[model samples]
Target chain A: MKARFIVSPVLCIGCRTCELACAFAHAIDGKLGKSRIYPIDGGFKELWVPVTCLQCEEAACVKSCLVNALQRNPETGAVELNQEKCVKCMACVAACPFGCSLLDEQHELVVKCDLCGGDPACARFCPTKALEYKPIKGSPKKIAV
Target chain B: MIRITINGKVTQASEGETLLKVIRREGIDIPALCHHEAVEPYGACRLCMVEITKEEWNGWSKYVTSCLYPVEPGLIVKTHSTKVIEMRKTIVDLYLARHPNCAEIQQLADEYGVTKTSYQTVVDGDNCILCGICTRICDEMGFHAISMVGRGHGKVVAPPLDEAPANCTGCLACAQNCPTHFIEFEDKGNSRTIWGKKFEMITCEKCGKTTITKEFADYLAEHRELPREYFNICDECHRRSTALDMGRIASWSKEVK
Candidate 1:
């Protein structure tokens, strides 16, 4: 199945509720109220782009992992990193042109959006409807002129 | 074994091997300085890049530093496509801007035929090449004595200014292992100079003619931990010095006998 997340930057309020919700969902306790949200390194809350993985057809992170740790989930259409298999090489981190992959606190592994198993918490939590997670029907085929 | 199409050519690689390694093993060369077989691929250089062909809708996308890329069955990879080459050239050019005079780097530039750097050399800056090789070597290999400082455009390799170590082992490992040859050393009579400027001097040991720079001699002596007398002059002058020492030894032997 092919899936895509559409981001409407125009509608984004820059409130960072999506970020907070993302962190909250991924938090150990899964409690938005009590969970401590860490700031995204090298970024500010004001310059927020309601970020969700593009799930690019040509995922650079999946291609760059030396340990065979990153793979495209054929089922979800999300690029996933197998943390146990990962060598913490940071190849995926550098290979990503979008600067989407972030180094985990250990500085070994990379952490990126996994689309939260299809029901994206970021999209659900967004008040401005900035994020839309939808299943794309068939592959986006180009017209042959 | 897994089959994949690289540059539209069918190739086979181990099931778990990275795409970078598979391509390299096939003799399709990709530039990567930070990658080493002994350690995990760092991917900081952004040099081993390739374009992977997805379905037609996405067309193509650029991926930098293929060292970590895993190969998948039926995966299509283009190591030298137009976009990949252009991005690699730009990255290499940026590295050149930080180290304009390194011979090794110049050679890579020549390979890509990069005549001009992407950006101007930072005013009055020392050699850096911006490859992150030094920082990686220190942290991964030497395990001490240095790290990267600052961030983004202001980033540089150095120890923290206020708390930098003084007893720097003078290992020369960082300099010797540097890909760009940006770090350098020069020993004068009393002191040693550690900077990035190039020095040329050649002196004849026998005739006392300046064959190469005195600075080169000093660099050798400092790095090798040799006495200044070893590099006092060029080869000719050194022969003369050795002959004089032999004569003194002969005289002393005769006197002792």
Candidate 2:
């Protein structure tokens, strides 16, 4: 089974290293990449929280795509955006309930997490054990003594 | 299954599908400016014209806008023919004469091999091809903010009474979808101006970044049945909270091989 990210905001130190790593990994031509994962300050101001595409089985971005540009990757089980097929409709941005789908302002294209072809940079570069790339069945039920 | 002949190749298509869709599925290229799957087909640009006939029509065939024409059994479609190209060239020529300043019209004219127009040029023509895609998308979005106003040559897109649209939630759907890129709007920091109206943007309470307009957030919250408090946090914080609710992160990384 393909793995997914399991983030722990409680353990997060909010260094934003994952954001940098994610953007760097996805960056092209030495330009600053549009990072898919964003670690933002939670309402309390002290405890920071990270936010990103949940890679839902039923994603709004997939449904909202007018040209079938966004589709599920069978190998990664992640929603991938077909940049060429997109017509810059911006429907997915408005349709996303959680607002995970982002419009790259410079490129005029909608962007989201693609699981980095099964190995996410944000999870790999996470200094703290906050972000974990685990299988859908990664967390097994255990009996507490 | 319906049998349709596209470019002399027999193809199978569903009964309800349009001829242009079937032709496109057969790997045929037909230029269309107003055709988008998100909205109903409106043959405004008059670009997708094709020669269509049937086996029973003998040696007679007629040109039809393929975007608006539906496929039928035993239908024969010619996507690109001498007569069809002539018809499209005429359309492009007329468009070029009317919209000499529009880059897209110029491009279309170039593709059709018509660099100049034979008709009288409109000295002060605007870029709006007026395909109605913007109004259609806005209607589909449930915001009847703008529509085609005026009559004949004076026709243009505007809000009611040429004033700021109260229904506009500062969504850029219309501006972004315009094929000619005619619609214009501006976003500066936490404020957005569009259609002569200004909107106060909703900044993410967590990251302090401007997200969307407060009017849009309120509309979304009410329509989606989400709590008003959720809109205050923004997507990042909500995603963070969702992760937190998904439970604990295990110690599997520390395990020895």
Candidate 3:
């Protein structure tokens, strides 16, 4: 099924569990994970919203890539960063509107979420249902991972 | 354009293009460990060895490392002939003897059906295959922080004087581009350790995320002429500020109406 990772600001407790989940899932060599999602203050008292890639339809990050490294995975509908072609010039870092594309300190490449290639760890480990990998309503239905 | 026959197929290539580049463009698989498009060919791995011949040489052929060999008119190349395969097998077998622990080397050996080494395995050896890619990439990145030290079996990639490289910006280009994944470094919290040197990494002011090392930032500021404040914020925070500025521009234009 075609899916997207969505976050509910109101339901987020700002526990940073999603951050931990993403970081843990992507960790290499026991290094601390470079989280693709993080909790940001949401203007009101005690209101923290976990922010992440919205996976925009016409992503600026994809456009700004010098080597055409960042691309859309058709099945997942997530922008995938091809590490081989990426030069780490940070053009995508400047192009992303919502700031989802960020630099990976260890790999020295700009990276963004890819819905974890199918099963998103952030949605799986989210304490609240704030983060979810929801199927598009009109897309293909109930194909198992 | 120059015409070169590769693997029984004639292809037109630009003058002086490396045979590996032209051969790769034709979808031929020639394993080159020390070869990186970002750096000049060092021919350290010799894995891309291919046999070449010409009609005027009376069928005599010479095996040359394709990464270093340039394409020439009327040159006939065999990328994976029996002799080329044998040479690659021998090279990979030597690599296996030296770097048995490295998964990359082991897998490469497996591809050539060289499960056991004919030479004595260096049990105490580490996975520096002496490919020189790391040192070359460092030089390409303008760091020159590491280089090939010593020679023969005792040769290794090390910083000068065996001390922490004072010029190392901790850019991780050397470690990240390592084909065998041999170069070692640690990035935990706001500090990074590599080449026996420790560097304090910069943290983003807005997002509190650790970014590049301070030395790398200062180097960019001095060499690339980037403002020192450019590295103060992480990419995400920088994008956020750009979005805010764009919003301000939109609102200001609206109010001016």
Candidate 4:
């Protein structure tokens, strides 16, 4: 199972388009075609984070989950949380050292990167080649489109 | 389950966990400041220090912030060795001196038994303690109204004094969120302008006793457009700016001797 997300800060221009794209991809409307969106407190920021799940071998969210809702996906080697089973305990919120997982606005479940189901929308929307989805081994060969 | 040795104890960790999460789960209790599970690892606090014993790197151990460091296969971690503890103590002490009165700082100091501060306190009677929390909050949490200026002993946290942004949005998030309560918003006599309150300045390196204003130093650097390297020199030291000409004066002193 592979687990890691690499980001090059030097390549990042701090544009925050990745954040906009992530919010759009996760938005209820499922489109990036608007300028004004309600400023959901504690959502994602506009900084170009190019963030992806580390898919930690020792996942904090998995260990911290009291309800055992969060688990590591065997197929993709990613930590996957069962939202139906999630009780919103926020233990995973406190357990994650990177502070990656966040409670959605509904406050019913924690939200995290699922690699956009193998085709990331954030990587797709990045303009300056700052965000790249790559394999976990060898050199991080840039994703072309 | 990935089996690994942490501080020589054989432990099992999940596949993608960071080194910090691994040791923390084992109840090793490594010290970490500026680390919140809800926020990304800023790595600014440098308190969650650990020595990694990596065989791939020829049994060489390097100091790293465990919070940001990822766990690797065959990696040996020493979370609490004598050297690591000492380093943590020194770092905690430095942080304490920078922010002497912060609650989180005091807590960490108490945990480390850091009763004394290592750096000299600024004379504005500030308990500053230097957690970098204010700057971090402004830059990382809020969108960047304030930032850290200077480096090491001369470092300070403040907003751009010479100019205020038209796009300020008047959030006041930086002051509202400061852990130290060092930042304050006040109404000037005529207008209500939120300022970063007051902070003490260090004594001039040359004058030996007189204290200059922190804003004055900032003014000299920013308004006068002086290079950052010369920012620490006081106006008096700068006024006597004739060391090159003084060499010609010194040549005549030998005749009187």
Candidate 5:
């Protein structure tokens, strides 16, 4: 059985604890760096949507990279970006369908969700049961939302 | 004293002490989930796994859970090897799969750099990580109020038959020792409710703090040998009145002069 990350909109409480946890986890030393997951507030109604790398099976970022720095890990099924091979051209950023790819200002490198090498900090830090990881017995299914 | 090298630094350890204790004593970082100072080491959560190299040991080097593994002489311990970190991350990933709402588990996942999981969600609205700290502490206190029930994804920290145990004395020991604060306790004016069981509360005579339950007060006065007069006032009122009495005595002496 293959594993997958699932997000539940009904369980989220709009706390944004997941974003803070993600930023701190990926931080260098004690300073909080870029967060891989971003939360979008839906205003006074309290509708908050958290966005991150979708880990698309047919990742558009992989095809758009001119330097071939973006590659997929077979074990984790995550699209990883190699900073050394990256030319900082921003082609992957434009090609990303979900707008998950970004240019890290401090490191001067493009960053995307690598699933933290098969363990995600965002799913771990969510205050509510909004995000989850588990195994699937049948064919692969992406979340409809 | 047994000597072991941790991260290239020579450190002394008493015989039978776990590697986690020795490494923490020398101020080294090793993340652990199930380890508590008061309870016995169960090693259910394998987050404290570390790589060890010993001369007399069979295969040159191997990985072991530090909380359960005892320290031996001439053992070279590496707290964070590439392999150890990877294992720690996977353990956290499994925890996240079961307990997505748990802040403590998620924080550990964040520190280990696991921002996502390949696994699907097993249980929804889950929070407990099954560390057994609450249940173990309850047993240690001799209350035996709650125990882990069910199996696998259905397991939960609940009282017998999902109703508050008749033997439960309404002590907040389980709540105080709980790392995640999963157990809910609501204090009303004259009563306190824990897991749907309500008990009469003890009110301080001097001040109106209703936090202490009558059963706990009696237990402390009888078993712990605490003076009953000490409970006459709330903790804040006791401090305040003591200071006022001291000030009055000082003023009386000043007036005499």
Candidate 6:
């Protein structure tokens, strides 16, 4: 199966280059439409953590989509949004476990990562390669407490 | 290409080039402390302050560090306005307060017309501007030995715990690049002290004079693929030996004739 988006906190230099790349790719006329990925400061002063959609197997956002706009692509296994079917409701925003979904104030639309249709721009422009996209074997289904 | 007016002189500047670079290219002097071409431009020293006036609806302009400020089209930049000069005077005065005895700081202050400062001087401490040049050089050279620690009044550039750094090679890169000459290097017999850490000095096999630390030589030999024989002699002795070998070879050729 295709590997998921992995973030390395150690490699990040808090440069916010990923935020700029994401905003540039998704923004309109220099107005950032709420970048899908957010670089949140970690416990230390210089530590940065790029928080984004993890594309969970048993996705909460997919299940919570009341309009059935969010659907998982069977081939790529990426949860994508059907803008036509979306009613601007923010159910998936609240339901997301990773806090990846957000409301774009400028466009008044809910936004989240669709993995850029299998080639994520944030991972591509990461200067330090803190974010990676690749393949993975069988992994643990549940988080270890 | 973009058109920018510096001191009312029209000049063409490439898009995204720093205002400091463009200003310097135009023979305009803007004093910057934390800017080095080798490393990234860190806007710490605030010495390269310039008033930038872009095409606007009103007569409003903003003060920005020319080092980090990018040149844009229809931008009006004034590097040494009365206000900018005054601001630089205050900045140099502040630096003078921290580094009271530093000749470079005194020179900068003098050049900016700052003779005295209202801020209290650090009497006993060494003059370190904390521009991060030394630390950045150390990191760039793959030493990662020294780093700036603490903040505000307690801020100091040293190894972790302010003790002898385990990874330090006594390379003197930090000392060599230090603008304020804050780093102290001293050699005593078979040991060298820097930042309160004494490292064992390696004696040159031929000259018998102290060279770099044995650990640093080994590290260079292992990590940098440098031959061990190169470290066996001091720089002076090595040069002399090379010259002697070349001379002997030349004389041998003459004798063969």
Per-candidate TM equals 0.43, 0.73, 0.68, 0.41, 0.59, 0.57
- TM-score of model 6's chain A, to 2 decimals? 0.84
The predicted structure with the larger TM-score, 1 or 2, is: 2
lDDT of 2 by residue, B52-163 (tens): 9998999899988888898899988888899999999999999999999999888889899998999999999898988998888778778899999998999999999999
Per-candidate interface DockQ score: 0.01, 0.17, 0.08, 0.01, 0.01, 0.01
Question: Which TM-score does chain B of candidate 1 obtain?
Answer: 0.61
lDDT of 6 by residue, B1-257 (tens): 99999999999999889998899999987788777654567899999999988778278998999989888889999988999999999999888888888999999988988889879987875788889987886676567889999999888898988888888877665775576777788978999888778888767666787756776666665664545555666543443443344344434444556
lDDT of 1 at A6: 64
The CA lDDT at B164 in model 1 is 34
Clash pairs for candidate 2: none
- Best by the DockQ measure: 2
Question: What would the per-residue lDDT of candidate 5 be over residues B156-240, giving only the tens digit for each residue?
Answer: 8889998868767686656655656677888777788997799987565666665356665555555544444544555334434
Tens-place lDDT digits, model 3, residues A68-128: 6778888888889886555564545644556678877785666788788999999999888
Which segments of model 2 are wrong by more than 4 Å? A1-52, A55-99, A105-107, A112-145, B233-257
Specify the highest-lDDT model's number: 3
Candidate with the greatest TM-score versus the true structure: 2
lDDT head-to-head 2 vs 6, winner: 2
lDDT for model 6 comes to 0.73
List where candidate 3 sits over 4 angstroms from the true fold: A1-145, B254-257
**Model 6 DockQ (Cα-based):** 0.01
* Candidate 1 ranges with C-alpha deviation above 4 Å: A1-145, B54-62, B118-123, B162-171, B185-257
* lDDT for B31 (candidate 4): 69
